[model samples]
Target: TMYELVGKEMTDKWTPPWPFGKKPTILQLDELGMTDVPQAERVNDAIDDAKVETAVLQDILPDVGFGFGSGRAVGSNNWVIGGNTTKSGMPLLANDPHLGIQMPSIWYVVGLHCKPIDGSPPFDVTGFALSSSPGVIIGHNSHIAWGVTNVNPDVFDLYRIKVNPANPLQYEWNGAWRDIKVRQETINFGDGQSPVTIQVRETHLGPIINDNKVDKETGEIQGFNNKDPMALHWTALESGTILKAVTGLNEATNWEEFREALKYWDVPSQNFVYADVKGNVGYQTPGRIPIRAKHHSGLLPVPGWTNEFEWQGFIPFDKLPTVFNPKRGYVATANQAVVPLEYYDMLASELGEGENYAISQEWDYGYRGQRIIELLEKLAPHSIETLQVLQGDNKLISAEELIPYLGRLRFNEPELNEARDWLMKWDYQFDMDSPQAALYAEFWMQLANNLFGDQLPEQIKLEGWAREMWAAYLLMEQPNDTWWDDASTSDVVETRDDILVRSFREGYNNAVATLGNDRSRWRWGNLHTSTFVSNPLGRSGVSFIEKMVNRGPYPTSGCTGTVNNTRWTVHSGSFAVDHLPSMRMIVDLGDLTRSVAIHTTGQSGHPYSKHYDDMIELWRNIKYHPMLWTRAQVEAAAANKLILKPAN
Candidate 1:
């Protein structure tokens, strides 16, 4: 596990042997605002202490929600390579950050040109920029192009704090009682409605997310009787100047300047891929990388009263996983376990391994990264078009790996037998028109649940795409495991074949009942179509208002871990796409004008504008448009131009 390796490295107390010596800067315990209790441990204890069944515990769990700036779980993919590896003798960079499909879209194309000052040359930067954010998030200057993918580092910790028995407003931390800060917030709905006021409290650890208070008679507070208060401690609270780093990125002309800009970037850590016109390429994982103490897994909540679990310090910036001009020719990242194994071993060797620590344990199941690497290895002298093709590639490796196993199953039922034969004869690509894709998806989902649904507790039962992925691994590698058996059935142990046949029959019957009996008409796109609508307005009482304003119901290919990831979710009663790549960009350093990009929706947010949904069909067809680097190109492509003038 990534955490195990990181823990081993930390226990060893090995530091990166960079040229610069270790600095004295360390985060104070108070600065971290950590509570003395571990959140997970506290929550687990509460769940165990509950008298009700585990299934009902879901309702008891606090409904923690994501804020506007929260980072997504493992999905984005980015890559960059040296010019020597490309056809045009220029570096190639591609990025398709996976974000939720939204109506105004998440990005806007922007070009900035600063006039020359002093002896410095004028700078030209262009690419995608977020709505209110100051600079281009993933873009290119005249000298270099760069992109980003999420780097899953464990930067957030939850601490459980012991409430002072004498005073409800105090918490024990570091052997002392500290009064929690309290604030009253009143939310007004206006329109003559009364305001609702709530009291918010903060412990030394952070904000008290859920205070552990149990009603004596009911033995429940809100829902389950929580044992202790838990406060969230995240590195983002003290993140460095991200805006400054982004602004610098727009002007950075070389690898050195680019890297220098990244020094100020410290929140929502990313895998930064770099490619310069100078023919150099590099990869860096940057953020406030936490250095956990010995014996701490960084998983469960730890006691806040002791300093042992506090972060020693951030990993040295230079020490964070980095590679410059590797012999592999290209660098790719897809939110996978990116820190090399050798780095962990080196750290373990340096520091004696008696303690435990962790960097991160969450990573995407490297299907996208694996597929991209395979294509890169085969395609030397690659072009921007080559990359564009690779970006749109919908080869379902997950299905490919498991389809053969499903085909070998001999089913007793006619529908099950027919479905197995159909899967065996079909190609594994998750193209929109493939009926086989739909069948395979359903089979995978059903078989997964059948195999392991009973094995797991109701609270943690695997479901959706995650379940399918896990089932693929288990069926392929550990088919003989007792997990395949249905625990409810007595005196009958289900074998892999027994489970496979039963799951197929069940899935086939469900598919027929829902989608009808015409196998030829069972198109994956019919059910898996992507949508982009103004969610708020669409749900409004005014029906015709938003219906005329939305875009999509467009056919798309791919599944959760594929290159073109268009995922389906349970909406209403049926499946609909809830996630997909929001944009795609391919930069060719040899010629800036030749670079191309396309977002899911068009440039404008206005519903009636010609540009609003113009790109929908193009995007659905898996196409790209000229990025328009030069002023002339942008002007030529402009439908309506606006010139701002200074007013006297």
Candidate 2:
């Protein structure tokens, strides 16, 4: 879908950090051997394959609905620029990783100063860390500041293996029968009933994920049949250096040290952007990217009977896309392909014929990235305040592009004509109170349904790959491209105008009913509100505990591509934004103490604690709090402190 929209030329264009002019393929990168990155099955693929059991699938959901896998479609935006592009003579960096909303929070704010042991300098770190971990996943120290968004490369692959009919425990592997490894785990129920035991089988490839049950009578495998057993091999399972790598990162002093530190950083590979007070900025993707054996791309399930499908080591760290201070002055990424096209030829050779390896095949549309670049290029000398404001910009550029096409559609209905006229004068911003934003959003949805609902189901059509720019391109460039013709209506081949008029009428009538007949009341915030709920409990049910923990129904702005990517759910066609920046960070290299940041919920998990939802209001208002770094600033801001002494 992305290829159809941007075309291979623009999608594969060469970017900075790639030293050579020559296009390199995955095969070429594999020759260098990078060796470690986080890996997960693309969630869509996992869903479509239907091999994942409902129970395991539920685990991914408590975080994001259907967390089948991590892909670029639902990711983040990050960028860094050199001092020349900044008002102050210091580099600047910003990051906001979008994820599902939850309470008790997913991030922990902390300041750590590990005293020097022996001759080493103290490891002074600050900023947000995963609530479960100690080291900073994205933060800054006195010398350098860094942030990350997922580098959603295709690192996980599913394989279909042939299970031996005579020996159910054996599977065919590279021309021989390989025995499956079984591990048993016992579950305790506290009550007197017997504990349940599960037998998990591991193949040479990885884990036999499809087999969920064993028949008690005959011992035959149940859920996933033996004929087509599915095994999942992920990069995360094989990589173990992430802890060490992140630890190294927390102590690194400069770009070189940071780069060196990342070599050990593996699972859930991320694009790391860095800026130091020394006036330096850079971007590096650190992870293990497998080189699929010839004739096999990682997009789908491959047979595991032969060695041809095995991975050939990995793409070396140096080959991972990296860029130092470029002449262009700024580096930006929005989960879109950061690698330029010049390197495609070399890498293209690695993929099968007619195949393209997107940095992450599931990347979101480039609207956000394009918008960020436009702003950066326009405001060359960026100030901290300006950049902070820019991070929350909600200008819907896609609406601007669509307005021209919509203007040309002929409408007869008076209400439709009036709606069209109103839209023509509308500002392309999804600000919370903008009625125009509501109109455009609803209109776009209806138009898309009218155009493609006949050919594709809502589930597939609404995916990021099919809905964003790809649909925009079709509406603008190929209005009469047969796709507009509803296959169900064979009586006539409907033209673009026919579909547009029908969709406009539908959207207008719906908007009137929902927002009231008064056109002025159709505010985006009325429908597009954000909610941060408790994990598992959601905002609704939780054994009578919803009132104490869940937050929001708060009005918000922005959609998938805007700087604030708060996406609403499709349920009942209501606009309850559930996905947005879990945390936002803007680093001021010129003055670490001047930097500002905010996370969705608060620092304390206790619902009664004052810090529980203190930051929620600020986040809902698109505001930020200072990231106090110096001891004096931290002490001044500290309301209470506790000193822990060693046991006597």
Candidate 3:
């Protein structure tokens, strides 16, 4: 019966698939119960491939019910500048999707086995994807590899429609007139499932975003396609599913095929990062990009029904903009603006330009991108291992100008001085034993809270605070010009100022009281902790905290916003009920032909089993083992494996 329904009122009836809306399934338990990222089954056999889209996900619900747990679609950030590539010489690709949710995690860690349908050797396509979908969502097969981070481009716009009181169906468009399209879908909730009905309307631009009437108490956002309603014609609606395209690409044999697969990329924009077994790397803006004439909807909503503001076309792939592998060896992106002003001028004839204030407003990409690039450039002999370490580095920081003032606090209070001794005696590395790092971080946050109660001030925030005085301080401290390059490369930088004596004194007092005046009491792991929860049917909870393991790699160490971070937890959604990304992997596609991989969880989401939450302890510990490479290996490494043949 579930298979019988295809595109049958999906947007209204699909209630989203998950057990008890939170637990993992039996298949999930079979695959994920492990201490490391599992290797693919090295089988010499192959089976008839199923149409993944058709066979894997069958939304049985009647109406187009929102699939996202929080009713949110997607979120992530990634960018690949023109600098880093392997050999074939292309712009490196990178992406990060910030899908908001709570618990178990949406990402599935899988290493699928495949025997080329074309009569080639079978190899594993290791990657991550939604559990229901088959194929590597973000990983390398043998020929090509890729990753996705959200584009976070602003595409949806609200319009305030001026409706005809006489005929509610008609609204004025442009200077002339037009009638909006109206439609309705009946939702069959099933026998005793409570059938329902839903009303939907559309316009030339897109769907009616808000309800026809506004809620006085709730301030609910309503939509009607007048010259003034939220008109949403995102690149996602017209294009292909990024997931499907990626799966197909995993089976691709060459770049031409890979690019062709990318051509189908649908909604929810992404900055793609690609690396092939051939060492060819490339980046692409892989979503439908609107070619708007004049800039509108920056400050306020634009009027719909106006022909003056419809999207003409999308940016073509070649013209979508990219820089291939540069002479330089490394590239990085943390969601910063891809194009500079000069580049924009070269692209559009009448580039969307208006209100200088609106133009200057920061478009999402904050200090993270700039920070990642600066750090990468400084580390010349860039290796993947270094990149991993960089992800978790924590360079000490504070107001540069205030370092001296901060230094004075230690002299002022004996208790504060104890904290300073612990901090001063250390290199700014975020080692688990480095109690000073935690103390410093806590103090920094406290100082931040004191200075900027909620959000940091425009110019004087921690980010700006470091840069302004850095050039001057670097010139003075080392005085060598090369010092600038070396100093800048660090994933993090140390601040030289201590303007907040009160914060120092306060934190010093708190730190000493808890940690004791002796340096023995000043470890960060003791203070800084990670809280994890298990939310099944009704409520949310937390049983896991920061684990202490002074071994191979660190946990949540290094720098915040640094490229290499051990503490990569996908904690998203409302605090009362959150949606967390279940897995975080650091894979190694050695030569892209065959490789090693590791992820938090195995291949499932079912609870009450070994694999369900098995990866939790391993992930929390920042320790991983080898993936299963064969049936023998899997049988040996895995707690157990089971087969669930789908009933025909």
What are the root-mean-square deviations of the candidates from the true structure over C-alphas? 8.9, 7.0, 16.0
lDDT of 1 by residue, 1-648 (tens): 212333333212111111011111011112223223223332222212221222322433332111111122326778887777888787899998877777867788888887889977676889998877877888898888889877666676667777787776787777888888887768697457777665667765576666434568986445211366666667765636889888888888887888888888787778889988878888777777776665565655677755667777777676566767766677887666564323443344444343322445444556677688778877777998788778888777667677777767776677677767877888777888888887876776677677756655544435445324634554556566566678789899887778877877877877787678999888878767887878577545676876876766777787776778776542123456666777889998888889898888888888888888888777767798888888889888887778889996
Deviation from native of the Cα of residue 619 in model 1, angstroms: 1.5
Over 4 Å off in model 3, which ranges?
Answer: 1-102, 116-124, 183-201, 212-233, 237-244, 297-299, 349-384, 396-433, 454-499, 502-519, 535-560, 564-594, 627-648
lDDT at residue 521 of model 3 (Cα atoms): 51
Per-model CA lDDT versus the true structure: 0.67, 0.70, 0.43
- Clash count for each candidate, listed in order shown: 13, 23, 82
Model 2, 1-648: lDDT tens digits are: 223443333223211112112211211222223233222223223222221112222222222211112433467878898888888878989988888777866888788887899998798989888755668888998789998877667677777889999987889987899998988868787447677777777887988876756678996546435866777778776747877887888999988999999999766667788899899988888877776554454655678888777877667787677777766677787766555443434454444333333344444456677678888888778877778777888986667777877788767667787789899998788889898888877777777666655654223324332134445454556556566788788898987778877777887887888889888877898878877777655544554688777777788888756877887543336667767888888998998888989998888888788998999889877789998888899889989999999999
Worst 10 residues of 3 by lDDT: 43-52
Q: Kindly indicate the candidate among 2 and 3 with the higher lDDT.
A: 2
Give per-model TM-scores. Answer: 0.84, 0.85, 0.64
Model 3 global lDDT (CA atoms, 0 to 1): 0.43
* Candidate 1 TM-score over all chains jointly: 0.84
lDDT of candidate 3 over 1-648, digit per residue (tens) = 122333322211221211111211111211212223222111000000111122211221121111211111222323332323322233333333433333355566666886667886565676666757667777666566676654444443345565666665666786655777888767685337665555566666665655454557985534343343454554444546767676567777666677777777655555566665555555665656655544442223456657665665666665554534433443444344443333333344333332111111112222344445555566534444434333444553322233444454446556567656556665655555676665665555455434322222222123212222222233334322222222333573323233255556666676667777676656665554433323343132222221111111213343333332222221111011122223343333343322333344434445544555556555544444443445565566666577879899
Best prediction by lDDT: 2
**Candidate 1 residue spans exceeding 4 A from truth:** 1-74, 117-123, 186-195, 212-227, 348-357, 461-463, 466-468, 487-492, 569-574
